[model samples]
Target: MSHYHYSADQLSQKQAYKFLTGAIAPRPIAWISTHNLETRVTNLAPFSFFTILSSRIPLVMLSVNRRPDGTPKDTARNLLAAQETKNETARTAGVIHIVTPELLSAMNQTAASLSFTDSELELLPDELQLLQEKDAPLAVENAKIRFNVRPFQHQLLTDRSDLPMTDIFYLEVTDFYFDETVFDAKREYILTEKLAPVARLAGNDYSHLGLLETLRRPD
Candidate 1:
């Protein structure tokens, strides 16, 4: 057997990032939508650095990296502002949508580099429908599954001088909306084949569901 190793500390930031992203296979993409309180414009973006943090509390975490200029990304900034809102009734909220094969093109369009004040939803194809949740931000109509989330906690991963590098958001799911086509009523589970979810790979690569297998847990 043979293995290769590289020390993260000794490697450049780009090198370490490439290694980590390449090593992490098939990361779930979080298609998040946030409404800018000050701008009153909606923002949408995809982040693969996301996962469920606590199933018991219905919490999910999103790791948002700062831009090259060390400025907070629009999504992170909006979420943090939402967290600090004092008015319960007017507090900001967001929506997390599932990315499927059908929505891949639209999702990629939203990833385009745009000003913080610009709304990405405007770039999406005209065929794509955008819907707004009761009090939450806008959501994709074609998404198979969508979660209405509210910011629960926000933490900045910073250096010694307190220069922020990444923002970690813990959001609590308040509501779930699933398309009937991908849901199994009797089994109470999502039909993976029907969902046809897309996942992120290293660089500009993405993956489909590919092979499916069922592994039973050992008693």
Candidate 2:
């Protein structure tokens, strides 16, 4: 057996990001949709640095990196603004849609670089519908599973130099929407085969759910 190791401190930011993304296999994608309160413009983007933090409170975490200009990304900014504002109705809430293989193309479209005034939803195919939820941001119409989430907390990650690098958000799920085709109401389990989730790999690579396996825990 052979092993190669590199110190993170020695690697450039770009190199470190490349290596980390390559080494981390099959990361789930969070197709986040947020709305700007002032512009009334909707923003959609994909991030793989996402995971469920606490099931009890239905909390999910999303980590976003700052832009090269040292500014918060649109999604992070919108979420933060939503949290600070004490409006009778949430003016900047969002929805996190679960990405599936079928929606990969549409999801990728949302990732394109666009002006803050522009909307990525317009680039999507006509078949892909965007539906408005009363007070929340628009939701992907046919997404098999989606979470109506609002910003719960925001944390800024900084380097030793005290330079902010990443923004981490803890979101609270207010509601859940699941498609009947993928979820079993009586069994309370998702039909994995039907869901066909796509996972992010290194670079432009992505993977589909491969061989399914199960391991039972000892009672």
Candidate 3:
């Protein structure tokens, strides 16, 4: 077999991004759904750069970036709602909310650009439930798991010093909601199979979790 070596410097930023994003294969997407308490807007969007960071404390992180125009993203804007929590329950529970696989399509629709006043809440079919907690919209009727985030920090960095980007928000997850079907008790395990979760891939592609394999660690 013959192989050719290519230097990282040989690639353009866009090229490098495509190569990395596509080559990474399957990625789990946090199909986030948030409702703006003040604006009365519900935004649904997907982020492959999301994952649960810790379980003991039940922490989740969403590595959100600025909009293409270098403006703060809608999701980031919703985090500001955290600041309005006057009640102890809302303050302790956090701001942004999370939705799981069940409402993936509805969440995707929220990603669309509509009038700020348009209500995505009405778009949900009668079957889905939109629970209001401290004035936050939640896809509880369909979601298998949901999370509430407490704003921890926001960092703006100049990665290239010449770029019109580089903003990251670090949030602390405070409250969590999980359906009974997705978890097991006797074994103390999360039954992923029952959840039928979907994940994101590069370029308008996604996948569902399938199959499982157990491999013993070699000591």
Candidate 1 TM-score to native = 0.95
Shift of residue 199 alpha carbon in model 2, Å:
0.6
Report the error of model 1 at residue 128, Å.
Answer: 0.5
Better structure of 2 and 3 per TM-score: 2
| Model 3: per-residue Cα lDDT over 56-104, one tens digit each | 7666667776666776666666765554453445533233334456666
Which lDDT tens digits does candidate 2 get at residues 84-153?
Answer: 8846355337899999977999999888988888988888889988888799888889789998888878
TM-scores for the candidates: 0.95, 0.96, 0.78
Query: Which predicted model would earn the best TM-score?
Result: 2
lDDT per residue as tens, model 1, 1-219 = 998888766898889888888989889999999988799989999999999999898999999999877889999888888888744675338899999998998999999989987999989888889896577798888899998888888888996677888999998888888899999888889988999989999999999998899999999
Which model is ahead, 1 or 2, in terms of TM-score? Answer: 2
Per-model lDDT: 0.89, 0.88, 0.63
